[model samples]
Target: MQGDTKLKVGILTFHRTTNYGAVLQTYALQKTILDLGYDVKVIDYNNEEIYSYCDYRVLYGKLPLKTRVGKIIRYSHNKKIAKTFNKFRNKWIDLSVECNTNAQLQSVEDGYDAIICGSDQVWNPLAIHFDFDAFLLSGVKGKRISYAASAGNITLWEKYLKKYWICLHRFDSISVRESEMIQPVENLSEKKVRLVLDPTLLLNKKEWEKLEEPLGNEIEKDNYILVYYLGKNRALTDTVKKLQKQTGLPVVLLGRQIEGIKSISVPAGPSQFLSLFHHAKFVITSSFHGTVFSILYHKPFLVFGNGNYNSRMNTLLSALKLQSRMIDNESANLERINKVVDWGQVDSLHKALKEKSINFLIEALR
Candidate 1:
């Protein structure tokens, strides 16, 4: 417990999420804030919709009747995987008292000195949980700030512009993760929005390394290409095959199980996810976090873009000067994938971004 003198901070983000990026980013932001001498807690605001996304039972019920059997089979196979993810959350995250509704969030408002809203796509309308004003610290008193909050897309829908514009005004300061989103947010809120690094990047590579406890000997010793495709890009399947042929290595697909590939049916928790990235000879992925860890670990990786959904990845690669690492459907070719990334230069850029982002957090909190 913190003494009375230390400021009590409540953070609002996707803390209960099972996703590797969401969990680690939440941890990074909390750790960073604690390092700054404040007592921090991730506001335990559990959105039923977001939580349902991870629950196979809820998911199976939503699927078509014809697909129910397959869904059940998949869910049964992933029970342990889900348990691993839940254990990570229960073990590592420091959560505040549970707040289910806006009223509940406001009820606990008096306990905090200030409230922080992000380090993720907490402003994204597509994220049903954040679409409402709760993550904006609505009804809360005192300082309200967003730290590296992401809109997650290049543009916001016209319908939400006015609503977001009004809600964003509550923030004393605004910092967005995507560089392309700064002006759009500024135009909406008429507030100066700063571009900052993702929370995971704010904490250096070594800091993340400490979180990775070995997942037994299940991890293969042989060098292999790690495939983590979160999008429905069939072309990526071919690309993975080509990479396997060229590299003369086996392919290990993380996340969902693929028929032809050596897919790990288990859902990889945060630590296991890190282990996969750390041990991989190379990575080919469509997920934002997949690309992030590849860079964090200084691994040579290729990103498969998902059209407009690829905007966040584009912004990250552009900012770090690693655009060549990305390959889209239009530009898909062996030549691009075979190209090399200069990790030495990338590391320098990451350091600069890390410092700038951390400085923004410190200043915003002060």
Candidate 2:
């Protein structure tokens, strides 16, 4: 605590999203700051623009009856998934009063000693639609800092370069999740940008295990290859099948079910997500967070790159000297899957980076 009263810190990020990585990173960052003895609150400002694409109410507008019917069915299924995500947020995240507009967020600006925006793709213009005000902490009176903030795998358009330059300059200190992001961000703001670990990496495997919920009895009984993919890649199914055949293990697919694959679909929230990763025999994934958890748990895993987003995963694997773990469509061979990882070396590298990341946070907060 700073002085007699605890220092209040407010975090601004994509906390309300249904994505597992988005929500888990938010929780990790909040928990880390809270552990440091500062009062931390996630500013629960809803971005209507981001929600507009997913809102079921949009179906109510004029459209073909058949199209509307299909959307409504999908919306009903999505509502259940959203409910589990909401339950996690309500139980774990300490959120500020709901702020639906800029004015509402501004009202609470003076309540914090510092406002942090980070550990996710908060700076990606495409994700946030170039909304510079909120995530950049525009009207806040507190000290502004960014921790492990990601711009994702995007090239800045000529028109938006000036916007990025102006808003990024608002931060008192800047740190990013990927090293490739550091030079570009520094060039834009003309300020030193530190390379930092994602907040999820700040917590070790044991700390993450405390949040895991048990799997169903049947799932717990089997030794399976856990496949967690974000994109619809036909190759992913074939790769998982190959891994299954190679390891003689059944497949447990997370998220949407594949049409031809014989796999079990697990409806998981953040907590259950951790449990699934922790128990997997061999992990196969195309997500950054999935790769993250696999490394954290020291699981034998293979990662498939997701287009431009591959840089984030590559940077991480390279740092730990585990680049051999990433496989492509052509390189997805049995030998690659069977390759042994130097867990001892990887953990040592991760520990050094985690300490550096924590030190960045400590100095930024000071």
Best by TM-score: 2
Off by over 4 Å in 2: 1-5, 52-74
Residues 1-366 of candidate 1 have per-residue lDDT tens digits of 234457888888887766788888899888988888888888888778766644555454567776877666666756666677788878888988887777888877668888898877787777755446687666778678889887666465466766787878777889988777888888877888888887887777788888886644555743778888885777787777677777678777776655566544436778878888888888888988888998998887889887676877888999889998887774357677657778888888888888888787777767
Residue runs of model 1 more than 4 Å from their true location after superposition: 1-5, 54-66, 129-131, 216-218, 264-266, 330-338
lDDT of 2 by residue, 190-252 (tens): 888999888999899999998888887768533888999987776677777777767777788
Inter-residue clash pairs, candidate 1? none
Q: What is the Cα-based lDDT of residue 138 in candidate 2?
A: 81
Measured against the true structure, the TM-scores of the candidates, in listed sequence, are: 0.91, 0.93
Model 2: which residue pairs collide? none
lDDT score for residue 218 of model 2: 64
Residue 225 error, candidate 2, Å:
1.1
